[model samples]
Target chain A: MVRVHNLFLSSDGYGAGEGQSLERPFGHANPVELGAWAFGAASWPNRTDGAGTRGLEDYLVRDFHRNVGAEIMGRNKFSPCRGPWEDHPEWEGWWGEDTPFHTPVFVMTHYERPALTLTDTTFHFVSGTPEQVLERALEAADGKDVRLGGGPETIRQFLDAGLVDTLHAAVSPIELGGGSRLWTSPEELDDRYHHDVVPRPDGVVHHLFWRR
Target chain B: MVRVHNLFLSSDGYGAGEGQSLERPFGHANPVELGAWAFGAASWPNRTDGAGTRGLEDYLVRDFHRNVGAEIMGRNKFSPCRGPWEDHPEWEGWWGEDTPFHTPVFVMTHYERPALTLTDTTFHFVSGTPEQVLERALEAADGKDVRLGGGPETIRQFLDAGLVDTLHAAVSPIELGGGSRLWTSPEELDDRYHHDVVPRPDGVVHHLFWRR
Candidate 1:
């Protein structure tokens, strides 16, 4: 299945905030507030305390990389660099040498670049429509599901093309006045998916959708 | 306390749909879809079945008319008629002869009209600002809490003035592409109010806000 997991959104439908920079990938959005749920999960990969909350959030946190073999993301999500790859030869993405993904990562960009490997995760900068990108991602994913990572517009394209099979969007209570909006309202995907709106005790509403 | 109860909204933050008219008070919004939670609740006054779901939603349904002694609504909510009183001379509003509201109802209008009565509910047409209207509503309430009946813009006025002490906004899963928006995000009120985004099993996310 082509899936999107743990995509956080604001009540007003903004996925990320405005004024994104290399220093702040999510722009003006307070990463602490946005990632609190994931950070507190017992299964959180980056948890330094050794113990965290074991709630439904923990289950999701554990499921983040369960069977995902490959990841696909928008170009902007890959790096803050907006121009040609030549402009920033030193930029190896926000993730350092040892990246998160254990599988191949496809970065959808208009300006294609040769495959670059940061330890285990190899990034292939490919340019194509949603279908073409998914084909490459699916092939790279092997038998497992391909996780579609987003910066909002990327996921929107996949959703619009009906290429997405399952989507798990967590809406945080905070609202960014302006930003890259994921959907005017999530119901826009109702025609193609069966939706389950589940809310956690911590004021976060999770929208889980599966293709019908 | 000045309260807003069961104020339904789309996921996009729209409280009511666009092009509201005499026939459709909520414009393009489906009343059945919007009120499903309340309609299914055992405490819903209008429920003919007598037996409905006994959940948090039901509790809210029962709480609807609790201590609310008076109601303050925008003129547009009172009547869709944009012109003068003469145009809607015989229009007794969308509510029938026996209006649901048993207490005094205050309708804010630029062009005032004499008070009218329909069974137990007395409709009082008054002109004033948010504070002014709230004061009148509070006075008419006679020590009881006042209900702020809205069409979105009316509630926005009260919110802007910080006149609303409590607000209960139920966000339905549906998305109205465009309409009268309640807030860019529920977080916009976070500065002055403590917000709780609680979601029921039926997919309705209730945003409860109380003045801090």
Candidate 2:
């Protein structure tokens, strides 16, 4: 059984982004807080020796990282281009050298592109339906957990298909007037999901749930 | 101006219960890890006591709490009743003698009920539109800030109205198979929203955005 995870950032009542620049799409909350909940222990800037503190953030970060084997992300997350990022072929990702994802990453896009190899990560671009991308991700993960790194649509597709396993959500304290929403419909959820609330000192709450 | 904040729980893809009861809605992630993020000096829990560790999580939590003057929640969060929580009328909130939201709390529901008063927190039930509820909350906040707690619909109304000020979202590592959809449309956003990304030790990422 493969576990599918979806990660996202939310606003108070608004959407995620303001301007169209990838540099600051979500606003200034705290990268450490966001990454801690998604990447877990792997969030540490230096995997080798960073002299980081060991606490709740570290524990959860490590737990999530330990479970994931491969990742699937939307083309927007993989590049800064708005539509058909192919126009600008040189743009890669916001993360410079030594990107956090040390495993294989699959990017979902409509345009075709070759596989990209960064420091310890390899990004394979797929041009097809989400199911096709998931199949490739599962193959890459090899029975390990697969993560859905989303802009929005990507996670919604997997979620609508009932393919997700566990969900961890960190609710930051800021609110966007509007941009892109994180969730879609509530009626779609039956008895399949559970809920927990973890309040952070930064006013963000960490919520987790899994399949029933 | 009154600021509206939204909060909720999500799961991995499989739709598993967060294993949350009225007692623990946060589920069963490592307590130590959660504590690290929630009880840091930056958060409200530690600012008065200095009980938790100091890190990025703490700082962000502190920033979130500092901006809040009051809170507004849906009837579901105030009580555990799902379809017709008012029918039972026996259930109250999970918070015991001393509830967390020490400030004023306005609950939106169709049923009319008496106000709930804990030590420092007071729960007021409003049976009007979200705008009315927000107006009362803003008055209660007294020129401070107001938070819109969630069931989902309540947050959606506020988002649709473009009444929120700042949004802080924590992207957890897991994905709920199904429960609540965060975003349904992209046109809901205006130019007032700004997003920033905050990475954490765990795979969680916190996105902070505010209305300008």
TM-score of each: 0.51, 0.45
Score residue A44 of candidate 2 by CA lDDT. 53
The parts of candidate 1 lying over 4 Å away from their true place are A1-212
Please provide, for model 2 over A91-202, each residue's C-alpha lDDT reduced to its tens digit, 9 standing for 90 to 100: 7677776787888999887877778888989988787777788888888888788877675566667777777765655665554445555563322343776544556665
> Candidate 1's error at B100, in angstroms?
1.3
lDDT of 2 by residue, B1-212 (tens): 34433132232312113453554444443333423335444245425553443234543454444556789887756765555564567666877777768799898888777887889898887889878889899899988888776645566678678787655545455545444444432223436565445556666665555554
Using TM-score as the measure, the top candidate is: 1
Q: Which candidate's DockQ is highest? A: 1
Q: Give DockQ: model 2.
A: 0.02
Which segments of candidate 2 are over 4 A away from where they belong? A1-8, A11-15, A25-49, A184-190, B1-212
lDDT of 2 at B40: 40
Q: Write the per-residue lDDT of candidate 1 for residues B170-192, one digit (tens) a residue.
A: 88899988888888778899898
